[model samples]
Target: MEQMNYSFSVCSSELDYDAYLAFLLENYAHIRLPYPFPVTLSFLASPLLMGEAAFLICNEDNQVIGAFSYIRGTGERQYEDRHIVQIQVACIAEEHRCTRLFLYALQYFTQYLAHGEEQVQEFRFFAPSDDSLRRLFSKISSLTASLETDSGPLDEYRASFSEWQSYASQFRQTALFNS
Candidate 1:
């Protein structure tokens, strides 16, 4: 992402439907996913599962290089919390991974999470329970659960905005940003 002229925008599900769909198709490798690519695509496309906030990270070429989306609230019907969101997806093109692009995009994301319409205070998410990714998030979040799935081991984590800030600050202090 160094010296790259990129743009950041939000995919309003109403107006930018195709944009988000295109990003998902272009980036997802169709491998190691808990559900089939088609199923996942449809689920993301559906209004019921679509996130309230979908951020697109694009390069100078107008191609989506990264995407981070979060649902408005935890999908639990009985548990109502407006300040908490559930991160649905965070994807960065393979070539752009571990680059300054993530660091930059995260700056925008955190700011919005902290002061956007909902003023999200905390978030929770799940990912493949690998040592690499898990270790990174675990440093700033509490591991709430580890579930065995056909695709792989899955882990759930929760973190506050402050905890997320601490995690993001590490990228600024070090040159290495793995996972």
Candidate 2:
């Protein structure tokens, strides 16, 4: 199969915020409570306002197909001592779920972190303790056992830059062959 090309852009006022918000609502609004409300434009734009970045993934025609956001945490707490980039959310359009678009978005995001100004020491996120998610993330780094938090039971995953590079390389090879 040929590689499916996708483009990524940081959400900015210059782009169509309304369309982006609509796309997010269409794809992710089903996620309820304790999860940050994603149905509103304000909520979707909050990450950009908070000095973090939100990226929109688009296909050849520039249609919004997926998105993700990350924020650098202030190392005030014990668990946050390292320079961490917490992946706030990652959502793909239903039709694009099993496609390489998801992996492409992740690859782009990881490359951004590896080469960007943040110099992130660790990447972190809370995900359900499920086989698929674990398999996907484990490609990049080792994960901690599921731990209970105020929100709910979520497994915490963290990866250093070196670890990410290793995974990125492997992902690239897999993508290359699969393409």
Candidate 3:
């Protein structure tokens, strides 16, 4: 089957947060915390004041199909001051998960990071142990797994900016051949 193509964008005030919240509740309710939907909307609507931002993957009609949020920060005084991009949450519609949407999202995110004011030294995220997410990420960079937690036994993964570039290159090649 031909995969549906999507355009990427940063969440903006003009976009309908109610629709986004409904979609999230319908598809990723398991990941939701006790926080009210308004809180989530507020966070997404805010500027990148706390070194954080959210991106959306949308269809031609501008309907959001996938979303991910990330936070960047320098380590504490005891640890080396390394720039880190930690993916706080990521979700894609079940149908879109089989497509190249996730890869495209990652590519878009890498480009965003590259053009940002601060240099990103590393990317970090906790992915469920049983999921293929870690494997997909490995295509972009080497990952060292950390101990598991109650949240479906997550494994933390880290990668460098150069690794993201390599992944983007591979994604382009694969996408071209497939097309």
Candidate 4:
């Protein structure tokens, strides 16, 4: 494999906002959102766009190869009031997937949460049913869950953060070796 080079940091105004959105759509074509979501243009230009969340970028040969977004849980924590890190999106160009790009990006994210005082005790991510998200999450120790309803439209499927992570980890490991 070619030498992979990159850096991780909070999304900044200097980056091309449109490219970020395009990157998401291209890498995650399987995701079907409810509507056409806006790109990163707002976040790049607006300070308010930066929330209790973070974005990571992988620059290789002066090109952006991967990006990820993580959010801090807002609700009360069950695990000793510890904050959790939730992954909103994790994308890497297909060409870079075989390398350690995505893995390193994730490592950077976890370290970022290891700051003083407010340490993130957990990490989470969710996946739609079709993907192996559930199985992957289960292996990582995330709690499995689903929508609770007697007879309703939204009562199809769901999984808790912990469950998702547990399963997703399995898939991640598989991907790491298979790649």
Q: How many residue pairs clash in each candidate?
A: 0, 1, 0, 17
Query: Highest lDDT, which number?
Result: 1
Per-residue lDDT of model 3, residues 1-179, tens digit only: 76576887665554544544556657656444333566545434332445356667788777777777777653453324447776666778776675367677777787777777788888876655644666676766556775644334656678888888676767562232111
Q: Against the hidden reference, what TM-scores do the models get?
A: 0.78, 0.75, 0.72, 0.58
Clashes of 4: 17
Q: Write the per-residue lDDT of candidate 1 for residues 1-179, one digit (tens) a residue.
A: 24767677878655465776677677677323466667666545543354366777788998777776777665575336767877677787777776467666666677666555567678787777678787767666888999887666778888888777666777653322322
Candidate 2 structure quality by residue, lDDT tens digits, 1-179: 76676788777764655656667778765332134454234446656667678888888889998877776774367435437877766778777676366656666776777667557778787676677778988877678767765655668788886777665566553332111
For residue 54, model 4's alpha carbon misses the true position, in angstroms, by 3.4
- Which digits, one per residue and each the tens of the lDDT, describe model 4 over residues 7-104? 66566553544555556656655433222335333322222243544454656555667666655553455334346655556666666664355446
Q: How does candidate 4 score on lDDT?
A: 0.48
User: For residue 109, what is the lDDT in candidate 4?
Assistant: 51
Consecutive 10-residue window with the lowest summed lDDT within model 1: 170-179
User: How many residue pairs of model 1 clash at the backbone?
Assistant: 0
Those runs of model 1 whose alpha carbons end farther than 4 Å from true positions after fitting are 13-15, 46-51, 169-179
Residue pairs in collision within model 3:
none
Ordered from best to worst lDDT, the candidate numbers read: 1, 2, 3, 4
The models' CA-based lDDT, in order, is 0.68, 0.67, 0.64, 0.48
**Which 10-residue window of candidate 2 scores lowest in summed lDDT?**
170-179
Clashes of 2: 1
So what's the TM-score on candidate 4? 0.58
